[model samples]
Target chain A: MRARLLRFGPDALGKAGVVGSGRLYAAVAAGGFRRYATYRAATLAGVFTNTVFGVILAYTYIALWDERPHLGGYDQSQALTYVWLGQALLTTMCVMGTGFEEELIERIRTGDIAIDLYRPADLQLWWLAQDLGRALFQLLGRGLIPFVLGAWLFDLSLPASPLTWLAFLVAVALGVLVSYSFRFLVALAAFWLMDGAGITQMAWLAGVFCSGMVLPLNVFPGVLGEVVRALPWAALIQAPADVLMGEADLLGTFAFQAGWAVALLGAGRLLQVVATRRVVVQGG
Target chain B: MDSHSHSHSQVDGSFDESHDSFSNNSFNESFIELDGVEKVFDVRKKTGFMRSERREVRAVDSISFRVARGEMVGYIGPNGAGKSTTIKMLTGILTPSGGRLRVAGIDPSRERTRLARRIGVVFGQRTTLWWDLPLIDSYKLMHRMYRIPDARYRENLDRCVELLELADLLDVPVRQLSLGQRMRGDIAAALLHDPEVLYLDEPTIGLDVISKARVREFLRDLNAERGTTVLLTTHDLQDIEQLCSRVMVIDHGRLMYDGPLTGLHEVGDSERTLVVDLERELPPVEVPSARVVRVEGPRQWLAFPASESAAPLVARIAAEYPLVDLSVREPDIEAVIAKMLHSMRDTPKPPPEQAERSGRAAS
Candidate 1:
């Protein structure tokens, strides 16, 4: 059996018009994007809510900066960038899988996971491809619009150097990896927990709190700030935010983001193995 | 083999009197083989608040059989009788606890992903298509997922759509389709890969009569022309009568009967009745081959072995008795199954050596 798979697996795939894994990944990613597009109303609603929150947070941070000079070592420009960029990064750093995480949970709970296992694609990579598509769409649809609104309305400062902008892009991509691996792990917990809601809520709460999504990590005094900086959650938000604000060195931020991406993705793969073996594929 | 007889007129076709037995020694050539395959599930039940008890449910118990290529076989039993479990094992969805199982000479559980390329499976109760996506989108996705050659995928898709009348449904979301429509969609999704083995679990479960007939016809053609080996699990007797040449009955994870569908009557020792109406009250009819078991005022009932032809006895009765009206009633497959299960309890278990030789348990 293994010999046949080794011999004809890729051969058959090509004959069947797969051409390569590139095509398969492209197809899955396209499916994810198209599926999200089907819910146009929901996407718009999410963007509206994000914009309202972005505007409100920007004003609130501006007011706080008026009261003090460099609170948490961030001046008015850096603080305003944190609020607006953080709003743009909200959907991208989906550590909870709210958008696509339900798919894994539903499949596991309903025994539809059986069909998932039957596919030739690796499960983690399949999901990662899907999130990558969603992230790209979010970046354009939700991320770009709100950031532009903040810049035009509040006179937000743009990154001065082309190098910093390039580093920010790299940081954002790595941040996706960190968030996706963690969401994948949270989703797989459905096999053991039987319900992913609790885990999902807890994961996102910890992620939002520690990643400086609501409040900048600099505001947290002493060891607490250092602790949040060391964790992978910071890579999801603070790393990208820092690169955009020029608060941290571009290389250091990219290194931490890149390191966590590889580590968490590897850990996610190991957890998936355990989940498959212990699978109690639910229902008929 | 002729140990029992019956006369069921409702049956559409005569049972294949000759057996298409698969011998143990010829296992090397068979398309599917299961030697003492067993699956035990560990189920935990709540004993009380904050307390639970663990138990084991043997879904497939030491089942052994072989299905030669192009053979359409029926795998059936009452609910919880392990019919689904056996199919799950064959598909490698659930690993068996013991024994050996092979499909196309490959161990299913150990190399399931590899073996998936060679097999197709449909569970009627579930939807394999993306529920919110249009039917064609699901098919297109499966086209990539299975890596089906573009030309072959198109050919199969066009054929299935034409035959299954799914041309109008391509743009509809699966959740909007009727049960029968969804089932047809699911079946087509499984076949897009052009698998050598097709395992259908209750393909006709919730379909209307016309839909059921359509599904049965499509399957018949699929097996005849493509020679796709099918293992069907269904509760509808007509499905078995119309499609499967061989029927296997399992109860409590034990196979009780394994042979032609008509042979079920003989195994169960069930009887078929002939109802006769007379002009007036009369004494029991005298007959050599059949005995009158009931005498209504103007109606008499004759019970005979269900496997035998009613022709001879009908001829003899016409020659001597006053017959106003008559009709032959076929024994229900459910009744035959009940009687078979009941009789099994009265007889001692056949020695394993003897049972294995026959390729069926005296279950």
Candidate 2:
């Protein structure tokens, strides 16, 4: 697979006129990958931070799961896995860093979005491809170390089947698409509001709380559990984590993620078209 | 490349003839056409606590013009004069609020993506290159994004790299490149797809003299060699003087003047200020063709027709008055447009004396 990817050269990108060409998206994804790969120091700092947070959260979960055994239908082992999974997926889902949305907001505020509009590509898909590359990088660079550390130190539920790993990858990919779509909609508010920072903050808060970053949605008491589980944010970290831990039906969880990805991406595409129509490029 | 050796004098002559023909509405081969195109922006300003007022700012009022293929045109105006607004409308970034606009027979705003393949734009204030990636990485990405064929991509890349002097800087990240280097990199990125029409907004805004000259030379050659149409907006009059044979002036969202470069001076009634330092403080020195616009102590400022030779005015002053030292200041675009608008408000046509002065200046 690596050799095949490397073999795709300039000619493989093919003609420019065709829309939705796989090679075109692949190149954009590669560009995105290379763009983030330059920040080696930032990646190191993020890995350190994620590992530190995972250790802290794992100890806290041990204490809580000890007091209320099998709370929210999760055994002690499963709860530990959930805690570590949250730490691993934090940056992967962009629950912690507002990198993509902040960049989009800055582009809109400074009128640099005009340069983006000049390109012969769909705006939403272009950003989606870039975000996928970023998520892949973050998952490998930041997600793995914390996960490995957690599994080594704590009694965590581990999946051994290659087939199950494949399902987890598919679930995470859909989760990334849903995350990008949701953030994209919030960023598009910059066209009307002129500054998306406030909305971005609110979006981030909701993502952190409802996506089960702070605590698993399954632990929420009463009606809130059902409510949080239904939100699009749940599709980002909670659903993917459930798939990884084998705590939920594989097809059912995949269906939930795929459904939110399609709905949110469709809404994002619609908002993008409308927002670009009234884009007031701030500077001459 | 051999055709590039054709003297600019011939190009200027042809441009003047085309200018006359264009004004007569006789040219039918225009690639960019705008008929009474308009763009109005609604801005809401905060006045007091929880109070705001909305106002419609007509950024590009009903302005119309046509740019032919292979013609290099200069679009000049003061800040907030709607110059960028019009370019935005032309590039389909900002849809016009009213009227018909077409580029290469395609309605730009309606079919913006299709039009994008044919046109390239450089916004001097912003960069489209990926900030964290190497300069060559941006080009490689553009190579795929535009999907220029492998052979043609290499050929165009080689040409731009050779002409723009981008070989050494390709490995450096975009953020590490200086403004001039980044600008060149950007220009090269825009041309890699072989766009037929190129729009440059303030391409030489912050470039130093050598860099500016190099950029201008590259642009001239690009236009000459590829026959690519160019619409350049700039504050630097020298950019207009050296690069463009036909200049269009826009102010207050209106097309104020569209003609040969020399005719702009005539219409604007622009003047050169001659600063004369006398031996001592005295009454304002008088000359036949120049008038003292200001006098302080031993120094005096004389305003004369910009098109006229300052040699005769200097000689007359030196022989008749004590001239310690003198220097001439060329009229800038803002001052020229201000004077032109002032004259236009006062008279529908050029006053007879001003016309005669331009004639003498021409001779």
Which candidate gets the maximum lDDT versus the true structure?
Answer: 2
DockQ of each: 0.31, 0.45
Candidate 2 CAPRI assessment class:
acceptable
Stretches of candidate 1 exceeding 4 Å from the true structure: A1-19, A160-163, B1-28, B42-55, B269-339, B348-363
i-RMSD of all predictions: 3.3, 6.1
Query: TM-scores of the models, in the given order?
Result: 0.83, 0.87
**Where does candidate 2 clash, by residue pair?**
none
Across A103-203, the per-residue lDDT of candidate 2 in tens digits comes to: 99889988899899888766787888899888898888888998998899998887899888888889889888889988888888898888987898898
lDDT of 1 by residue, B168-282 (tens): 9999987799999999999999999898989998899889999999999999999999999999988777899899999988877766667788778777878889998878898
lDDT of 2 by residue, B1-363 (tens): 111112223334444554565545533567787777888777788999999998677777676777888999999877887888888888877789998887887777766776787899997878988898889988887877777889999999999999999999999999999999999999999999999999999898899999999999999999999999999998888899899999887767766677677777877778989999999999988778889899899999999998899999999999998889999998887788787766664654544654453333222
CA deviation > 4 Å runs, candidate 2 = A1-20, B1-28, B41-57, B275-287, B292-301, B314-327, B348-363
